[model samples]
Target chain A: MTASKPISLKDEGLEQKKRSTPMGDALRQFRRNKMAVVAFFIITFFIFMAVTASLWSNISFLDAPKGFKARHTINPAGLDRVDPYAEPGHCARDGLDQGKAWCALLTEEQRARFPNSCRVEIPDPNQRQWCYILGSDGGGKDWMTQTVYGAQVSLAVAFVGSSVSLLLGLVYGMVSGFYGGRIDNVMMRFVDFLYGIPGLVIIIIMQVYFREISSKYEDSSGIVGFIVEINKDLGGLFFLFIALGLLSWIGTARLARGQVLSYREKEFVEAARAVGARDRRIIFVHLLPNIIGPLLVAETLAIPGYIFAEAFLSYIGLGVQPGTPSWGEMISRAGQEGGFYSNRHMIYVPSAALVMLTLAFNFFGDGLRDALDPRLRGR
Target chain B: MTNVAKSEKVMTAPAKKKDYGDPIVSVRGLKKHFPIKSGLIFQRETAAVKAVDGLDFDIFRGETLGLVGESGCGKSTTGRTILQLHRATSGTVNFEGTELTTLKGNSLREMRRKMQIIFQDPYASLNPRMSISRIISEPLVVHGIGSERDRQKRVEELLERVGLNPFFANRYPHEFSGGQRQRIGVARALALEPSFIVCDEPISALDVSIQAQVVNLLQDLQRDMGLTYLFIAHDLSMVRHICDRVAVMYLGKIVEMAESEELYTNPLHPYTQALLSAVPVPDPDVEENRQRIILKGDLPSPANPPVGCNFNTRCPVAIDVCFDWDPELIEVLPGHWVACHRVT
Candidate 1:
């Protein structure tokens, strides 16, 4: 028995030696998943782009007309002066002249109404460079630059909104779960009450109400004046953060409460208590670490939901103000007059970005869930 | 060992009831009932699970008092209640002449430093995320006992004391086997230099081979530290091996308690007798010849126990009064206490 025991023990020792620490094991697992790795890189690339949006926007690919050059112009309504419904790649081929292939396509009455629609003589043809790589929107802003900048707003809202929810949820849930009895019942019921209310409708109403209040206090002095300045700077996106944060936390709160409720009864927690560890220590040091695996996964998964909600709100025109570059706002504009047919890149670029971001977050969250699960450890 | 047993028997002899010194911990009429709440919207009181219903016992200083019982007989609840881990619904636990039930906040915590518990499951007792050093040093950190360097030195010393390598301090609980983790649990429990430790089935979760090692370590610790232990377990042989006195519990009440050798040699209570009979003898001839008294029916639910004696429902020698009147623990022999109408 002793000889066999040593052999089996030696095998176990070898196995143990091969296995890394839990955190290291999780990282290794995450690296092993090819799709998750790809998603991680894609997310990182977008974050990089979002952070360096200003640098990308300043590149003078499309120069304003020089001396004796016919400048590309937009109508008062922000329509293209040459061809309002010009397809992507049209500007590069036509050089803003519009007479070559564009004029023949227009009706006689349309041509008569705007005689320079297709044929505008320009001395410096080189000045009319189509620098908008992903093409331009109806407002003629560079699509690529707007898309890059929009990433900043989307990611910021998602990150900040999720963080707010996570904080509130962790505190509220811990209090409810740890205390239990009447306090738990009352607090959980309040959570249920919040869950009963439709979050989207409340967010929209809050946005409108806060926007009106912000505008009224626009000139107020002191701290309120400072807040007003910030509000003006952020416009509706500021309120969007508040609304999203307030509305999205219920799920996290419920999850945290449930996790804590189960984990608080574990013998380790009881052991901590037996050692005369205070409630704060028990909750933060003992209970929190055990429940963090599930909470982390839940938080990761919740981020994509917030991002999607932001896009959804913005798509419906209840989100960020008209002037701000947001993915949803871009997608909304792409559904406008001749947008789908002519400037399809405007519709697809932002839409593709939004889909890719949500998918990346979800895939990464899945990897995290699998890697951090204690039951699946040493697999 | 024989001389100590003879002296303990003489001190606890029935004729001299007051000879035993003041108990280190005396629990009087301890009851811990968990309330059951039902209904979704407006929860109402449904029923209470009387886990530990009116237990009374005294644990002398520097001695191992074994609490043996069938599963769900509330041995664990009694231990936890004594430690004040679970608040008693009603009763008093006097630890070294201080009423523990009345103590609260800092006083209760200060009391807790001197009294610690080793849980049943080593796997669940130690935090998986914490290194052995952190787990052991936590009690010291909580009470602000020493500086960082002192705590580190103490942790390493504790690791060595618990029969584990000092270098294993940096490893997490999951890295160790069941026996190793139990040692870590012991190390953590001993960090405060607690005067009393409740070994709540400490070796039950370990392999049969490793169980003796843990028990020996615990016995050595008790001798070395002069620690009092309330050793709760269902394993009769092990209790007989280490405990000075043994208490047999049935449905949250102690049916019999006596010196370990006396109780095993001559069990007075019928339930105690039956319990002892269940233990298989090592000698095949004696095992085959011995009569095993198998009790009828499962343990009655503690939430709604039988009206009179809890064991009366299944007592082999129950009298007419056994069904109507509750039996009280009374001395029937020197150093032997039994709760049964027939025994008296």
Candidate 2:
């Protein structure tokens, strides 16, 4: 160090590529994990299926439009959608043979209600594939289409609910932990109390109250009215979102506070203070990046939980509008309509979708938690 | 808030160099005691750790004042207290004309820019989340010293001056070696062009070879910039090599202070005698035959230091008077000072 060394960067013989950042390091590690990679693809495939559900839905015999312009947009009322009440193996979802087999188990009145077993088979193979692809629920809704639409609902619940949790929890916990003393004591006690309450029960109570309020004010004109309108359009999903989101932030706050407690005493934080940086700078700059890794992995892993919570609420008949086609709604209505008596495929289709999604989220999240730190990745 | 902005502008402007040899930082009976609080909710102080019991020293402008002591002897605490990193418990630390203890808010931070510290453990000192360039220019950014382009240019200059390649600025702290990371810490400290720096055992964490390189770097930096330093360390040989004047401390009090050569050849206090003797001499004959003065007993707890003179519990030549009265630092020679009743 007595004399300045004259070696240039190019002469050092290191790689000329862009330097790896923490995110980049985490990404490099994520790509190396086989389960995570597979889970990532599967999740994206679910998203693609959800986003393009209305396409390729129409069968040939229904006289569905064949033009590109007709198929590009959503077919809400066209032959693209099956008779949601059509029996599982009837012309609603499966071929003539399965339809006859399923029709044998139904009473005469039930047989008359879903007329799919009485119709002739359509000769088009592509159209036929759309029928038996996942069969249908008690509503005669195509199971594959319902599964795709359920993905959309799950994604909505996950993102909106998690955002609420992350925003509220990060700020609450950071403030509580950073200014820890009486304030931390008082605030953390409140969070602990919130944790003790059954989150599902509280959300159910909230959902019941929300339903009454939204229906009573459905005709008014204001923010509440506006929300009621969205609720009607989304088929009661809006209330479920609010109920689930309001209760999910407690765990995130606890995790964030714990992380902040551990990081507040690190030397880098003291070094930042030594540089004359203000408290806000210390919290956001020096402190946040170090703690955000685990928090992110937790949030990702918790998405499946949010999805399941919404599913549970819907299953108990306290979530969504009657015909919303959410997976839980499908399962609940199938059982009520007695599609499970002999035609068991009604329950099997939606259950398989639910299990696959939660498993995918868990595998991806587990891999992410391990790979978030750059040092850990290197080792 | 505006005051901070104004101070930032003033600090970044051209620095006016000052003459050396006059006292730059004057400490008078400075003390720091950390409270040990009990209870979870309504906390109470049970005891206090007297890290720096009563310190009095003068750091001359552009000179390195070596502070040597055994582990847990408050050498690091003294440096931190002087920098206002840990507020002093009592007395005064007057930097130039301003009394440091009374400073608050923007003024305190403004005063902080005039002084900086190079911390030990290069691995822990730097922020791993930031790039090298961001770490170096953090003080500049905090003070709002320059435009982004200007800060980048200044960072590059500082890197080169600290003997690191400027192009490595984009890399993170984890990519660098311990020695290079120490150099980066130096660059960060030098970013503000502070008049005084507390080098808090900057070389203790490095290898023996790396320690020499870093010490030489610090010396070169001080010479070129005319910076004053309070170099705190336990390495007696290294302290002797780099310090113009040396102060030996025991149990949070200076036992002897004098020119490095004088303290080495003509030590007055028994504590200083034991410390210097512990440093291995280079010559084989001298190393084998040199008289060794090994003191007894472990260091007394800072929470409850022994009454009267702190060294009485371990001093080899203890007298009855030594247990009842604490000695004060007083000049016995032209420039040499000793804090022992035996010294004439």
Candidate 3:
């Protein structure tokens, strides 16, 4: 026994004194990818914008109407508001401001002081005036402020929805896979039944009905009432969470179940059983760590889908509450009105933002999969 | 290089056989059948792979009972079924005195303190994600045998006991070589101080040079701890040196059993004779001169084995009775048992 007992330092000398787990190594690999790093920073910037959405609305130069959530006009005298549709410089050429004194030359002095405040371009180069920046939707809301604040509502649905789905899918898949028999059969059959029904239609119906029911019960004093009031305060994002979370987990559940089923029969599990470890311990401690990598990659890639689902719902005019400034709602309101033909900026600005965030998530998810799974790395 | 060569020299040199005490583990009609279910809508059990059709053997205390067979012959199944790792289709495995087949939940776990298994593939058996310390101490932790501090000490002790450096406990399974990982597996099996161990082809996956060192380490551990082993292997020579008695299996049933040296020199069953003849002797003169009895035909499927003797399909010498009536393993010469109608 002594002949084979010596510690070979040369072989083990390659190992570091500090033991970093596989997850740590995967994180390091992910950091090394340039596009993934760029995507991560872009996503982080969106989250930062999301967190400071209210700050943008309050600090803008345009006199944002007090206590008005949706509309942002330039001043109290906005009724003769340059007639945004008729001509770009309708107020400026020959002083046709309807005898309003400030509109003539006093506004010219204010424009000279804060030139960056106006982002809208007038077609007339001779007499352009300061106006709504990034143009205005039909509702008169500023495009820049709407896009910035829309991140709050859009991101809330993205995060809370996916987290809820991940939770439910993990528990459902683990139970179904770990106790595979009549129980697994019954649980999976239920999922298959749910799969047969069109998921988007059900979510739409649920969102509409839940909003009605919540508004009706918001004053009562129980859990339902508490949830209703919270939903109202959250700009109807609570019901969005419930709708997206309950239905979207079906795909994740299927993914997780497959991962669990494959790892359940591996020799390490049999080894754990032979050591007298209980079923619960084997599933949670031993089985979970091995299967978690692929599940995580799948979830990351699925996040972009969640963001798009919210956008789709809002685009059809059923997304968040009315006053909540989601990019989808802005696009829907813009395009549904005559703004699609009249103002090009209103449609493309939010569309560009929507495209950027979702693309970043997709890129980051791809990089994560390659980092966590070596077999998929080069390919 | 000299260490491996010297150990190889010692391994092939047959050790003195010693007397064993009463059976520490006994099996009665052990069977393990894996059902093959087919059909899409209405699933039905069409057939079964009778891996261990029916086996009856005793692994005595302080002795190694080697179970040898070709790949599909159910040697590993016999060992796993005895330990209740694979639930017996129908049989009793009495470990010391407790009937292991009926035990479940905490009762089976408590009884598992007396028995353990060493898996075949060292890489597959140890979880890659877990550190080496966690792997070796897992059994002790599961059985609630010691406190956290105590388990750490025990892990180090077990590591060193299996001829591994205790300092390497923090490293993962991928860091170690095949021989070292096998030793780590050995350490895990020995964690709870089990009296009986099933070494399931423990050295087959190691290098030829590393194989000798691991085999010698197992021998040393056995002598010092007085542990019983159901050493399952395909290697006839390695089994001869390590095992006290050896059993030869064919198509899901044990065909012959006797002292290792006796079974090798005087094989009663035709299948065992064919198996031993296939092992080339080291001495060229004797190996060339020896009459080789190469049996014809591949082994019959265990799912639908031929009637009468399980080995009758490939058996070299067969009588008319060997095709109809199944022969029971009966003692032909006091300690030597053979299941063949042709055997007296």
Candidate 4:
């Protein structure tokens, strides 16, 4: 029976020859979770959209220069091009020009009120001349282009903000937890002080302060001027990254500090110390890797919070400067002068994107939590 | 063949006489007090936990010295302090004719290469994220000992030496059982070819069947390498099997010290006798009829140990002087030491 079992097991073992590493196991676990996989794909799609946003927006009909005539058949007058809010599928009315009888259902007064609304003329021969796929916003800009471009800003903020926080938090927490004495006490208390302050308030103050500094040196030609130039190119989003990163690190720092506190006592760290590993090596090589599982999960979950915070700040006019395309800024525009009722797509488009992004991050983060959990490894 | 014979002769002879010419490491009045603090904003030191208080011992060349005590008796702290893993609050650790406690920076790190420690928990001792090869090679990498290829070859050789399959080098610690992980740990400790190692309860966390295998491996390694060990454990039987001499601790102080055979056969200190009495004999008749000395009351907190002697609060043979004056560790017999006034 044992001989027969060995023969069967050998065949099975050959099929399972791929060695299972910690990372491989985690990836396998992540693949098994259906929702997390879907969320991961969604996030990947958004990332793709964010990276290629300029390409998408450049060709968009809604991305036409201000006052540029469409010169299309939809209306020789190009009335739709000048309108602040064009309804989606408005081009369906142009089919009336093909002599569709449905146009006759329109009341005589309605026909008089919108004489050229349903007219069809030859579109511009130039391929570049196109219309909004999701319709135009209150500013006569393509909603599709704005959305794609807006995604770039939000995603960048989340990625850069979270990375900055992770770096700061990892260093701060490692130093605090590893040194562990009066230095740890002082450092943690400082983190506690940071925790007490409202993140948005600090961000607003920093944004306003940096904005003044940037403007003051805008024209001066020196290192400060060079910084101003870079700041201008990034717009006020640079300040947003700084503010979010600086304030957001407290949570990650606390989590990292707690992890380090426990990990510093682990025998591996002692073993490392016993082997004459320097403090830097002990913290980075031995301690950090052990604590990384939880740190990664914490970082993943924190990214969505940064995205939401960016959107919230932008909505209140403290985020990206005016004229830069942002989801929150678009939502703010949508709420103005009853644009919400008239052009609901403008509001709904960015809102849905924001909601989906945050939800995707949350689901993906949850999957990562399960995948990276040490207790589940080797199974 | 002559070298092998000479080493064989060295191994059979009593470890105390042949290889114990001079102490490799000497610790004098070692103290490690951790401050307990209170108050949030303006913290105040409320009290100090004397984890290790006024310990003195010497580890000779190529001899295994057992440190036996119950949990929280500061045996682990003593081992760690001797290695300079934890800085002593006061006193000196003299290793290889240099005062280790006084050494700093590169000097201390240099000294560390000569000493190593095997941890109590094998699961926690090996980095879970690292492959066995990486864990074994980390010390070499830190010390800049060899080229990458050389390190890899050494790692493979070490894995084989520790009785693990050389192919297992690529596997993570989680894939191994407790015993295998411990072997990896031993390989790591041996990587630098250290003269001394603190086996901090190395086999306590292993299965009974695997415990003997690990101990035998250590013994074999010590024989091959001429390694000295401070074997810290609470398992008296296992300690007796491996250690040449043993030091018994209570609270934060050593209560007794002697040759393993003498200490077990004729324990003089009240605490040592009580501890030895608790070790169950294997024979059915002896196990059933052994006179167990159950010490009354729990171990007093090290933060507020009894003023006279740490063991006074729980000493079964306590006297008035035992409560008022601490007894020093004195040589009661040649090659035997005890720390109780009542013994005299």
Between candidates 1 and 4, the TM-score winner: 1
Worst 10 residues of 2 chain A by lDDT: A63-72
User: Model 4, B270: alpha-carbon shift in Å?
Assistant: 1.0
lDDT of each: 0.80, 0.79, 0.78, 0.80
Q: lDDT per residue, candidate 3, A247-354, as tens digits?
A: 888877887888889888877888788888998889877888887787777887888888888888888867777877788887887787665687777787889889
Which candidate gets the maximum TM-score versus the true structure?
A: 1
Q: What value does the lDDT take at residue A130 in candidate 1?
A: 49
Weakest ten-residue segment in model 3 chain B by summed lDDT: B3-12
Model 2 agreement with the true structure over A231-344: per-residue lDDT tens digits:
877777788878887768888888899989988877667667777999989988888998888888898899999889878888998876665666787677668777578556
After TM-score superposition, the amount by which residue B163's alpha carbon in candidate 3 deviates from its true location, in angstroms, is: 2.6
lDDT comparing candidate 4 with the true structure:
0.80
Best by DockQ: 2
Q: Residue B329 in model 1: shift from native, Å?
A: 0.4
Consecutive 10-residue window with the lowest summed lDDT within model 1 chain A: A61-70
Deviation in angstroms for B80 in model 3? 2.0
TM-score of each: 0.87, 0.83, 0.86, 0.86
Instruction: Give one digit per residue, the lDDT tens place, for model 1 in A2-94.
Output: 211122335346345754466887898888878888989988998998777767765522322221111323432223333333345545432
The Cα error of candidate 1 at residue B178, in Å, is 0.7
Off by over 4 Å in 1: A1-21, A60-130, A211-229, B1-22, B38-46
The number of clashing residue pairs in each candidate reads 2, 7, 0, 4
DockQ, all models: 0.34, 0.43, 0.38, 0.34
Q: DockQ (C-alpha) of model 2?
A: 0.43
If ranked by lDDT, best first, what sequence of candidates would result? Answer: 4, 1, 2, 3
- Worst ten in a row by lDDT for model 4 chain B: B3-12
